[model samples]
Target: MAKNNGDGKLHVAMLPWLAFGHLIPYLELAKLMATKGHKISFISTPKNIHRLPPIPKTLTPFINFIKIDLPKVKDLPENAESTKDLPFNKVKYLKIANDGLQKPIQDFLKTSSPNWIIYDFATYWLGSLASELGIRTAFFSVFPAVMLGFLGPPNVLIHGDPDNNDNDNTIIIKRPKWVSFETQVRPSLYQLTRWGHYNSDGENMSDVYRLGATVDGCDAVFVRSSFEFEPDWLNLVKRLYKKPVIPVGFLPSTSDTKDDDININNNDSSWLVTKQWLDKQEKGSVVYIAFGSEAKPSQYELTQLALGIELCGLPFYWVLIDQRGASDEEVIKLPIGFEERMCGRGVVCREWAPQFKILSHDSVGGLLIHSGMSSVIQGFQLGKPLVLLPFSAEQDLNATYLVEKKLACMVPRDVDGSFEPESLADSLSLVIVKEEGNMYRDKAKEMMSLFGNRDIQDQCLDELLHFLSTSIK
Candidate 1:
């Protein structure tokens, strides 16, 4: 076991992608590193920083937040500091805005001279700046190793442009030349050829470019995963990137269970009501449905999801937040009289609720989630079964990997990736009620030792810290 290296206190500057999914894990990692007595210069936009859960008092002294202004771009919405504020398609403008921070960030590095600067895929240009300043850099991937494996090496991501398909999208849909595993973990036909990679319109800031360049340039790569899971992919990334590939563990919350309330305000009425309703349900009976803060199902999908849960006929707690970032008047409308028909079998909250508290409750038998890494870990933390409804490519990757592991059941979608109510209903019932789903529940429970183990996570952190603490860095 790698012990925390207290002999050398290293400084690590963290800059994750502007999305909440990435930001939260990076912050969790910051907290873990801080516990080793290292200093952290955590950077993000002002609004995102304001929205993040409060840093614990004990770690406050070790972490310093650096907020940079997100430059105004032509198409970006007002106050759209993070991906949560805009639809995924409009996020191209946000990347253009993120690039505007290059100047200020460069200035900070020159002044602080941190031992190592860690960054996400969005900052493809960051490695050059770090190299010039004589500082080491690490590409701290907030994504899982399986997705990166499907992405292949740097050259494949860059030249195999989905639009400029070299072989009629055949190359993408098929498993890469490298992956030796015989599994159904590759991207879908639609994901590969049709609705391919996410890209920004204005500049050379397409996701393919950013991802390829970031991996190609970084000194090393660190994944937010564990050796116990995706072992092949974890080791494959080393051969693919030709760099030090280290698993940062599952990043289970190192904080105590009571600390879940830190993100919730004392006057939070939404949590209060949600908790009261959960108290009424039978233990291990309620399906907790939430697509996360950033993903808002379209009216059609929303209707399908809502009606699907209703069709499942199980007690459920659903937290509904429309990510359209619309005005209050444009509130999410469920199917006409949908709630009335449910007759109190389900509870829906339009406002924010403490997700951790709900997942930890006895009432939550299984989770209906977006398959984001953080949510997946949370479900695994409590040894609960999962019903996955993925919205993006990354989500697809996570969901597919979990399904391959027999720990989750992805809501079956059409070849075009659109899901119907019937499919959603059947998937939920199979996971939460049917005996066939017991394997998923049992597998999730078995994984609790590895995924929820903070000691294992701490040891992974120690190894990474040891590398950062070396004099050469």
Candidate 2:
């Protein structure tokens, strides 16, 4: 794969995880890289490849898609459409896929090797195999600096202590004393307990450990965040990694794309209709509500949320992905007359929506969100303030990062992973009707200017191409 520099192009490969959140960023990163005249190959399972929207064939002339097969596993559902429909959560599927892709990767490397491979956390387990084949691999962490701190090697080594898993909502984690000036030592006991649940069963604990081990072996590590939001921990991570730890800002570009060509746009003509409705609203008045692809609120909580929106009496658009696996009759149990009440004021849609476009819309002033990283990035980049209702996973940490750091406001959650209506109403009132709301909106705009630059993509692409082509002396 070592072509002469006179040709003036580099070759790179991208392997994203099965989840949509992971896949979207990798696609954006690939697009950015391809803009710099690099040859790109994207590897994924066939099912996921087909799920991608069709891009302009001209824009991706140098790109190719490679599909790898996974072996049959018992008790797994057949013909699972997407990661959401998989029999197990992402962690379990990651391990199985890592083991399954080993042979295919080896064969591909022997025949046609790319200069470098960029991968996500789920595929970290393949680093050693890549190294054994004399290929360099880089790891891209898609979470905030603090969550990355909790997931990085240092935390993993000390995190297994029994006291770390206490049931209290807060845990005090002590960092190196010298770093105390810029850093405050804190551990989220609630988050740890939740992560324990996230990692339990099917050797999930071992898989996370494997993930940390893979990070340790990376040629370089790039986190998709900037130092402005996390000055202290960013410095701490640099010291910890002691390698080329680059802060490439948020890797997703918010530039307007040709959405008419996207495959996911085929369904739900209502989304476009809603866009027209949103355009008619007053600027900075409409609330954009979405709970992400995986977060399915129970009928009870869904009712409360709906009623809360009705009570707030704000113009809003909500993407309610019904994951109850219930029939239409059974789905009627949520909120009494809630749908009928918010009918004109709200536009409620099912399953999928064109989220990026919705977030970027001029009429979207605030977001009622679950704080998933992808949604968080979308909101942050779009300069939209947030009213957080974290469902599960790293969302707790993410919500805390946004609210505690003055990026967004948090709505209350219950002990059983549910939300309340009155509290949500209060949060909405504060974010929408109060002076503090304006302050948050202004801060979000400033942060957006820092992280959501169109130029960072070009810079990242340039660096990646340099790393791929220039031999380290």
Candidate 3:
């Protein structure tokens, strides 16, 4: 067994996928563990580590950042550490490069000999490799517990090779036979046909197999969710996996931030302008619209969104992101003369807006998002009702769960498999403005007590710490 510090404090290491959504939560969890007087070693590419948000002065002592260089691959872009830096077509090469970290990580295990290692799905090899050196491992999932339940057991993950084309869409389109309870979440036929092969272009091992290997080799599964929110799903995961399912809390990005920082030290120029505009609006009147960093709409869909927001006629603030390679001239194209026509009524800022501040503002009443888990958690913390347009299968699962809970309204898609401006307008009106939206608004407000409560968040972390302290190899 890996040795500990002998004070019930363990030395834990963290490794997550190369995406901001994954990295931020892993770092937050690290800070939480470090706060409990445990040691942390956060490993990532040098660039990704440098790009993370500034670490707090107090927690810096306990959190140690270990930067390693990823072995260069054939087509990977220069200094492309995170998903945000690369286009979709090039992401396959990035995965190839990510697999190259096995050697250095093996070296880390040999020298540091941490008591335990918490890892993401992508590093499937780490579990077995760490086990050889007598170290314990846990799978730190950023997805919801229900999704983990949906992925089913280790046998399905291992035996079901994503690259195997026995029955193209027939097998995956249907829900797993293992799911005994009545659940509404499943990957759509279109999503499965399009993105199903675990996004394998030429990679040897698919993402699903990676997840399976990670779970099979790990001692426990640490999910980023709460038992209070989804007890049925949590229980299902436990029964199916037949292993310890530890809910590591929602790990809200705003947990450690002081209340004063929201209003005082948040001096980003982009936020200052946004605050000024929001300050003038009536309380709970504006709609906040943003698709997280990774989920971007096609240009045609962007036009539809522009028209839809215009049709809704509600005062709105839109943050339009220009993808990594887009130049100034390639700014998101709205309908001709769209901004001029909607001046004073709506503003589209291409710059980064402070999302937490915007969602928490009294002037904001609702949020329109792509159902990304991190974004959903942030919005719920401030009790903002959601209008969901999920872009991926995982997002679809989250949207289904929220709709079942009566906390969100889904924008209907056309037979052509694309959403229309009219559907967008109607959905936004129903969730943010119309009289019928009050129920959703009320339910979202009720969730604030669960998502925003720090004591509950700390309690979850305490449970995690307790598990690690007691469960020795």
Ranking by lDDT, best first?
Answer: 3, 1, 2
lDDT by residue for model 2 (1-473), tens: 32434566766778876666667667766766776667778888777777776554665787788888766554334544345554234446445644567688778766766777778766655677777766777777776666666444534543443555653334333442334443333334444555566567764445466556657777777777776667766776777666676665677544444232123535647667878888888887888888765566656777888878887878888887665222212343447677787777788877567777777778888889888877777777778888988765467767776676778898876555566678898898788667867877887788687667767655755565666566421
2 or 3, greater by lDDT: 3
Would you give me the overall lDDT of model 3?
A: 0.81
Q: Model 2: what TM-score? A: 0.86
* lDDT (CA) per prediction: 0.81, 0.67, 0.81
Deviation from native of the Cα of residue 340 in model 3, angstroms: 2.9
TM-scores for all candidates?
0.93, 0.86, 0.93
Off by over 4 Å in 1: 1-7, 161-167, 192-204, 255-269, 327-332
- RMSD in Å for all candidates: 3.4, 3.7, 3.0
Q: Which lDDT tens digits does candidate 3 get at residues 208-235?
A: 7888888888999999999888898889
Which pairs clash in model 1? Answer: none
